[model samples]
Target: MEKYTGKSVLKGIAIGRIYWYRKQEYRVEKVETADSEAEKKRFADALETAKEQLSGLYEETLARVGEDHAMIFDIHKMLLEDGDYLDTVNGVLEEGFNAEYAVETAQNQFAELFASMEDEYMRARAADIRDVSKRVIRILAGIPEDGILADGPVIVAADDLTPSETVKMDKNKILAFVTAKGSSNSHTAILARSMNLPALVSTGISDWEAMDGKIGVVDGFGGEFLVEPEQELLDEMIHRKNQWVADLKALEQLKGKDNVTGDGRRIDVFANIGKVEDADGALEADAGGIGLFRSEFLYLGRDSFPTEEEQFISYKSVLEKMGDKKVVIRTLDIGADKKVDYFHLDEEDNPALGYRAIRICLDRPEIFMTQLRAIFRASAYGRVAIMFPMVVSVSEVKRIKEIVGQVKQDLSAEGHPMGEVELGIMVETPAAALISGDLAKEVDFFSIGTNDLTQYTLAVDRQNQKLEATCDTHHPAILELIRMTVENAHKEGIWAGICGELAADTDLTETFLSMGVDELSVSASSVLKVRKAVRDL
Candidate 1:
């Protein structure tokens, strides 16, 4: 038996035969084209075909995974039309290269540019560029897009998978997925989570090809992969897989049940979502409300900032869908891992702790006010609360409140309808947690963003896979910070909630409840599981 462990994207277990996923390879050789115009025309035709394919894929993915994941195809389509990318491809064609060669050149150059970026999220974009370029190149070479083919259900092992490739796989044939390379933030990982598949990434398996057709066990909960397991281990893993399946079936029974402790203490179990379409999933999961609606999706994958009307339409859609449920939307938390080129952000050596989140909003109040106006306008439709991210000081909260007050007065003067909105700040930094008492007095509520809280407290970069063991969210310092923030918020007649990855961790669900946390917001899929934990406590 061979044992390997990696990062788990979802918690489950799968016992199946391994299916090595080797993507179709295309060799684009440089060919001297007599007519550069002909090659350019061919490239244009291929671009059109690629866009058509992406459109169909977008619709298909939208129906399967909802609009949030489907938007990746939209981004891919936008890249095909990007001027700089077109210029690079056309430049290669102008040098008398064939259409396929031109696309191949552009792919290598653009992929390298993104790969050299400081941020890990930006680095992941290299895969997108490669995926798009491959599509165009394949069309030029008269090759159909690739899809995984398996005779039966099997665990898929790949070096890595692009979002397009991940989406195109036949889900029915997939029992689990194991990859040699991927981050938790990768789109492939996101798709795996949305599909509720047992997945492990960054396994660093150099000889995965040799393990093809071998009996493999993917223990996603423990982040382990067993290859050609002994009878004893195989039986144990099969039993665990059965139990995992049973637990999922059991969790369904907890749906629509109140998240109350044995002592009759009720806690709000909310869901964190990025797009308005995700509200449907939240409702299906029976989330009490939305604890963290990330507002950044409005600004990402676009050439320019979203208009006030556009933002308002999205916010209002989600709010109206949730009806009377409280929806806490976090303002544009752009920067760091999430980058928008049109924002004209300066390059930083370390963006995670650099000029990001609230800093940008305060520096550019015009942009911030535009978003605030939209949220306030949408509030008239349903319960809405706005939270600022990466806030570290009382002065920042005061400034945000001052700006919000101005927005409210401006809207009132303009005769615009608005609602009673609650204001809050994300207690993600040590400074914010340490001075929770002072910060609590300025906001109506506090939501602990444990992802950043743990990272900042431990001085470890969460993106660094090598330091994963060190960046523990369960550290005593992080727990103490949560406790402090909750106590301070209660002292000021406000409430505290957790709106991070840790919120869904059932092991810590009781700990958070014990800390008097008013809410726990995780992904929509985790709502019932956390609710069960709370009820069990």
Candidate 2:
């Protein structure tokens, strides 16, 4: 099939052209030299509405164009805090260029700094930040966001895509997405995958000015986007589309049906939930239960820790939602890239390697105990399995057990019911995976959090977009660890489940089944896909 090749030199903003590509459109603007007040007025009007729309994104994730991600916010912070970025952009704007032009110059001025960074994730993050700045400048200069691509199933083109824009998109109109920026690890990938549309990332098509409404086919699995598709290729994709739709319909029948294998092995299919919205997927998909309710959201998106009563209310809602089914809730798996501005952790010289998870819980017993008290208090409504993250040693497991004991004592003293809460820990780190047999003897069950396990074992940072190629779940080392984890856990008479991206790896589900993983806890979207995978296995 013929591909669009001439857009290689044009940027999304420069030359009034978007290097045609397949990617997510965080927002679109044609950056060019505008020399009139009428243009400036148009820019101001767009900025006002853009800010209004972006205001909805001030939550913990700092989602949307404004909130935490607003380029103006970054400049304001820099200007207020005393730095070079704000000064540079201001100086450039004073030189008579439009806001977009000034912002582009400022972005270009930082190119050397970003290029020199050894950390791929940090560098990629800089690119995303610069790209965001261009959009903000365009809005401030009266450049309208490119309208929802020229109709039909449009492949929205952009230099990069943010998570919020990706989530809020009209999924019905977006058949697939291709991005010149962002990587597989970006939440854009997660959201797009959730939308169940095929997408390809990092195609780096920054110059396709004519790509709007142009026919393109994205082979998501192959990470390939073919533009100006040939008739033969179109026919083949049409065939594949029909087959996929038919298969999806068949998979839908599995919803609400028990996941007892043909051999009569009943493996509970549970949803790994983060937000209240996740419950919608769980209930709608008819999950057997909510397996891993990430409690981070309760403490996140706000300025401070939630009160115990507040936490209890959230926990109780989750349990009640599942009705009679089991819901395993992980208590406050904090730290890593997800941060709450108000809940300040001293910027550890090495945040990822320093006080996080059990380390933080141990140091701040009040924080951990309060969360536990809430979970114990909420256990009355339904089955609640309390899981811990990054548990590397049996001693850490024992410490958590002690906290549970203390919380039970405190709640019991208050005449509150302490429902039986099953205890578990994520076996993700190499140490934890290796000692799963011993740890399983102490804990009731084991959850294989492959995301971190892969990182800790391989020493690859998943957040780094540039080196995302290194973050391979299919690597033999990760697969071996998973196999070992399953073996060691069941040997101690405890069940093991997977809760990482690999949990739903249809390519490896049979491999995991062969290794004896008792269950699989996946995102709601993967429930049906993994169901199909399990059947194939």
Candidate 3:
């Protein structure tokens, strides 16, 4: 084992690796199964079972998280539609192949595409697609995902990783992650960083072939690794590891501390959550409360609208998480995302500007009404902050708020548990940025989703590989947007927070701190680094 010491990004930093595997799963079935109805039937059954198992997981997540998570299964559904995967496999099998042979040939095709991809997001998608393929093979061969995570401690290294893999990771035993193919924005990269697990990815520098278990220290943030580490190196890693734990202890002390800078400037730190239960982390982190509780999660994973009771139960769970802390919940922000499978929105020419966010809420007032009614009903239980997303106009805000007012009145008339809920908007577009001051007047606060703000402003999809270099956060326009929003929010006596990837970046923490952000709603892992940066600044 080699100890590597270098600046590491803190993507998925959690309580030191909870799960470890001494040996990595690298088995590949090499038999060539000929194309036949029997083969297709076997493959279809495997896929169907995977679908059912995944659906169960999906439903469970919805029950715990909310409907917003259902779209992932909708994606799963696409893989099953018309036996799309089966047909693709059959096409390969028709070329005179066995299961192993078919897997190899298709894998080669995928490898070529992965090689040809220029965008990091697109390249990372290859891994997810590969995971899907591998699972299909596993099903056909009767292998299971059982006990995979329980297999003891080792740094899981691969060419790349997917969200499914990272999200499924047993935080209980897994220690760390390393990959040769991914960069920061990849789903796994982001998830690992959020989990507070040390990871190193995009290591085009490391040799995956020769480096099986020799041992290497991974610094996730900056993507550094050392191989065949000496004793001195091991000591340093142990020291840093200890320092990391110590730093966590220190941040916990700041739980109730105001996010104040050296000059007495106060920045609010809130947790971005999807459901009410998600507020637990925010409260535990000693955050002011929830910054953005995307209510869409309630509507997303289920087949239809959640009954008012279901909505009430879900909202109540979050109120309990905060207890006395404030929770800013966003009413269903749908249009732009594939949040509802029934809607099946067509691939838009310009999704950033398409029918999404607050627009969708206004268009479908009933949908928004259910959530607002739930929030008001839950308001008696805890401090609730109500916000809307994709608000580029005052008219949209006015309409949506009016509906909320209606819901509150209706709930009150019905003798429901009604309470005061502050209204807010997500400042995620150039139009919204330009008029944030106006929006500030209408809403209680502004929560910036920079991922979309930057993309909409620059007219560049950050996910597109060709624009990766151009999709920088430091662009003058983006900084100015933050500056203006902060100023506007303050002018209105309303707080402003950032909930995008930028909120989690340690390097930029000082810059945002300097700019006068009221809150930072970032991943869990980033709390320490951001806290450290804030403490220093």
Worst 10 residues of 3 by lDDT: 14-23
The Cα local distance difference test for each model comes to 0.88, 0.67, 0.67
lDDT of 2 by residue, 173-250 (tens): 666666766666555565555445565666666555756545676655345567666788777766766776676678
Question: For candidate 3, lDDT tens digit of each residue in 408-509?
Answer: 778779888666777788888888888988888888888898888888888887645456778888889998998899898999898888988888777887
| Candidate 2, run of 10 with poorest lDDT | 8-17
In TM-score terms, candidate 2 sits at 0.65
lDDT of 1 by residue, 1-537 (tens): 888988899988988899888877678899998999999999999999999999999999999999999999999999999999999999989999899988989888998898777775677688799999999988988876676566799999999886546645777889889999886645557657645678999899989777999999999989999999989878888898888889888888888788988989889999988777779988988899999998876877544567787799999999999999999999988775555777998888899889888999999999999999999999999999999999988999989989999999999999999999999999999999999999988889999999889889999887677787787779998999999999999999999999988898999987888889999998887999888888888
Model 3, backbone clash pairs (residues 3+ apart or across chains), number: 43
Candidate 3, residue 279: lDDT: 63
Which regions of candidate 2 deviate over 4 angstroms? 1-180, 194-197, 205-243, 256-266, 348-350, 465-472
lDDT of 3 at 263: 69
- Superior by TM-score: candidate 1 or candidate 3: 1
